[model samples]
Target: MRLIELYKSVQGESSFTGVPCIFVRFAGCNLRCSWCDSTYTFQGGKPFTEDEVVAQIEALQPCPLIEFTGGEPMLHERELLPLMQRLLRDESRRYTLMMETSGERPLGEVPTEVHKIVDVKCPGSGSAFGSFRMSNLDALTSRDEVKFVLRDRRDYEFARDFIREHLQGKVAEGTLGGILLSPAFHQSPSPLRTADNMELDARDLVSWMLEDGLPARLSLQIHKFVWEPQKKGV
Candidate 1:
């Protein structure tokens, strides 16, 4: 596995926020989003064999949650599936595998057991040119989710409208996994708290969701608050 870093941390975003999770952050990404926080993952990282990666994960045994994220996990196509399969091999592991993706990759190759958190890039991310596969929506189970990181009012508007136009039916029935609308944090110079980490305000964004009647939830980077943002591990 071409890995950037592996460490244990509380999940900062997603439905599993606050849960202690072992993160497998891989190097390299196709998109250079304006608010990309893990810029460190976009370049050089230590390479590990699939077995080595799995061993590191098992070392963090009790976490029960493993997140495969990246500069873009999908970019490392060859190793992802094998790593996931290896991690899930132990029923006793009880590990809930998750991956954070840019939504630019084909979901067909991803193992069904992995909970995919697909971040549908909004206009403000500067990756609007990237094609999002509409067919991938069908592959998402209730355990899967879609995410949109908002940068400003324009981003919020785009997100709100996107949900209304392409995602309303799913939101209305509450059958879709879920929609997450978080403001872009790295763009905000003023840190939200003493943590000195850039991040979005959960309350402010949640209010927008309520006012717009959007089904999306506000996802804040809890780990950012608990630890230094630049730090690799919890």
Candidate 2:
């Protein structure tokens, strides 16, 4: 596997927030979102075989959750499957394995036991059309989540429309398990001024959700606020 970095920390997002988790950040991505933060994972990573990668996780004794994230985890198609299978075999670990994906590839390749968090990139992200594999969404269970990082009101509208148009009929009618709407964090204009950037404010996002009664949760990248934002490992 072309591994970028791995470490143990509190999970930043997802329904399982604030829990201690092991993160396996892989190398390379297919899309180029303008606001992407992990440019480091796009290339220049040290390569490690499946066994070596697993060994690193094993060393993080007592970690119960594992997340496979990256520039785009699915890009490294060769090593991902075997790695997930190996994790499933570790009886002693009893960990909940999850993956953060861009929703560009065929997810059937992933093991059924692994939870998937799919990202639906918004228009403001230059790579808007590059995300969201509509065909593979139904393949996901309630355990999976669809996330959108809103850059502005337009992006939020796009997300809402995408959900209503594509996912409404496929997923069960009443309630969906996990759907998150997060605003992209930007500080160039001014760090303390929350609404300085084109990104939507949390209050506005909540208002939109309440007004339309959208069936999705709202989240923030908790790790970015909890620790040094630039630090590679969580």
lDDT of each: 0.79, 0.81
Give the CA lDDT, 0 to 100, for residue 15 in model 1: 91
Top candidate (TM-score):
2
**Residue-by-residue lDDT tens digits, candidate 1, 107-180:** 87788888899988877788553457777877777778899987667778888888888777886676577888
* Deviation of model 2 at 206, angstroms: 0.4
TM-score, every prediction: 0.90, 0.91
Candidate 1 stretches with Cα past 4 Å from truth are 128-130, 187-204
Q: Over the stretch 111-225, how does candidate 2's per-residue lDDT look in tens digits?
A: 8788888888888888555567777776677678888988889989998998777666545553345788888876343334234343577889999989987877888877766
Which 10 consecutive positions of candidate 1 have the poorest summed lDDT? 189-198
- Per-residue lDDT value at 155 in model 2: 89
Off by over 4 Å in 2: 169-176, 187-198
